[model samples]
Target: TEPLEKLMPIDGYEDMPLVPLDIAVEPLVSSISGIHIYAYSAKERCKNPPADDLTIDESASIMLYSMDSKFGNKSLHVILNEILKSADKNKLEPWLLYLKLFLTALSHLPSTRRQVYRGIKLDLSKEYPVGETIVWPGFSSCTTSINFVQSELFLGSAGPRTIFSITCYLGKYIGNHSYYSSENETVIFPPTQFKVIDCLNQGNGLHIIQLQEIQPCFSHLHAPVFSSISKKPSSKLTFNSVVNHNTKWKQRGVTLTKHHSRGPKPDCLYLPYGVYVDDNQTIYIADHGNNRVMAWKYGATSGQLIAGGNGSGFNGSGCETNQLNKPINVVVDRRRNHVFISDSGNMRVVRWPCENGTNGEVII
Candidate 1:
């Protein structure tokens, strides 16, 4: 449909757009930042990819390594059958190795096991389960491996242990060493005062277990065992059993603040609301009534003023960066070495670069 001149130019595009032969054309590989081209694939769409498909030779090698008669031919057969069905080869070797290590660790445990079981039936599902969703506000990240002591191992005062279980969080092993990602933050849950409400298997080799804080008084009778046995009477009035239910806390009923008496002093706190402790045992307290934030060093008698302390009462809003109205909550950013505070009365949240900083920047 085009004219002869247009048709000629269209047909001659290859020759017309040709570069001069004398011109030096730099190759793409010669560039400082080389061009990266990627090919799209379907594997990217998976949530928990089955990357455990191993070669026949690798599977045979694993079977050879597990040639112990104690492992039983039936167990090996089930494992091999599952491998043929859908067991991920990538997870196989590590899991097998960890299984051997876990058994060894179990044998090395200090406590004597009252009971033990052999194995359970393996039910392979085509896909992982899906369920309800819950949100954890303050948690930053999830840990890979969580270890815990048997609940029966913990013993409380009065010789009546109420602890159902004790759990621990540990890092996963990579070769001969264990690896913990320091780039992400770690969460601390208060001990002897929490209950697991629900547990969700995330299907990605991870589980999300929700914990709720509960009173320490709620406990079942688990056959009392005491580390320090005495012929002394088990009366509540005695020094050995001061209360019917006593926690194993070192500072049984001692208050860190107001060791002498309750008052607004360099060593005492007035209406303290927020508290944070660093790894070095340094304490940061937001003394709300005193209109100040205080930092107490480890074993120090008095606290040094970090923010505010001008005067009590809501007489005037602070006009300076260091002044605070009434801080109610405090948090520490360990990675950045910063302290954050909820300046409640001032209707703002602020952060200081360092623990001993005089001035703070408004966050909200």
Candidate 2:
């Protein structure tokens, strides 16, 4: 019943334009055996669509199809998927526009990498081999829970069943926007390629298959790159909100970073209170948690200890000439090849030589 779990086949319709829902789906009215109750009610039903990349009408187009249940009979998901999974490629002509709109809307939703569940009424383990790649041409109907897939409401525990634990990389969860929010629906848009990790027959007419979604070596349908619909520019390095355009943050690969630890080690950084970037792109960090300053040359993995790595000033033995305590800020006096540190815990500013300084000179 969670029709929002459906996505159309986008293989050959890469060049199709994003027309309105009514005009896009008009070609199928005479041919397909279905009905639409929410035709043109996109604005009314989808008052708060998730993303801003697509227009309201564009977002509503997805919402309409997601909730549209053929006047209380067959769902748009079942109908649209039936055509998408069809072997006849010519049948896709009428659905090109709708497919374009559906794919574009799905492309706007944020991607979550986790395992999603899907249930089939029949055992399909024989078709998939270990280490083999498979492509699901149609939209994948999946839920976040295995219990939901096994429940009596969905594919019941009666006949032969195959449960797929799909590790989807770019899966979209549209359950909140669907008519059935409790289904915990998350879907994989087509033509997503998957590699079978393992397939096991668990006896009693039950089977389990582990699938990992992967980028295929070759293009399946030449899906156009929709860079405009993405939430952010594709970059290897993660960025916070409100990125400064003046900085070269959008560079292809990562530059300098510290994540999730304060370190006594050269590579680890914790609670960095200050940073200074030199003209040569070498970065100096006030590793506040470690009571030391670390300097990293451009593209270097680990940092070189600049000052006060022995211990903190307040650690029973008291401040040593070679030690620092709670250093808050740092600046490089490049003219004299010296580093000035605000040694706050010791209540003084200390100047240390960058090239060769075992102990800092109390300059304050």
For lDDT, the strongest prediction is 2
In candidate 2, which residue pairs clash?
262-270
Tell me which residue pairs clash in candidate 1: 52-88, 52-89, 52-90, 53-89, 147-168, 148-167, 148-168, 151-165
lDDT of 1: 0.36
lDDT tens digits, residue span 219-328, model 2: 43455445322232121111112222333444486545545364578887654556677777677777766789889887898889999888887632468878888676
Model 2 misses residue 222 by how many Å? 4.8
Task: Find the candidate with the highest TM-score and give its number.
Answer: 2
lDDT of 2 at 96: 82
Instruction: State the lDDT at 141 in candidate 1.
Output: 21
CA-lDDT, candidates in order: 0.36, 0.69
Supply the TM-score for candidate 2: 0.54
Q: Which regions of candidate 2 are displaced past 4 Å? A: 1-12, 33-36, 41-43, 49-54, 67-74, 220-364
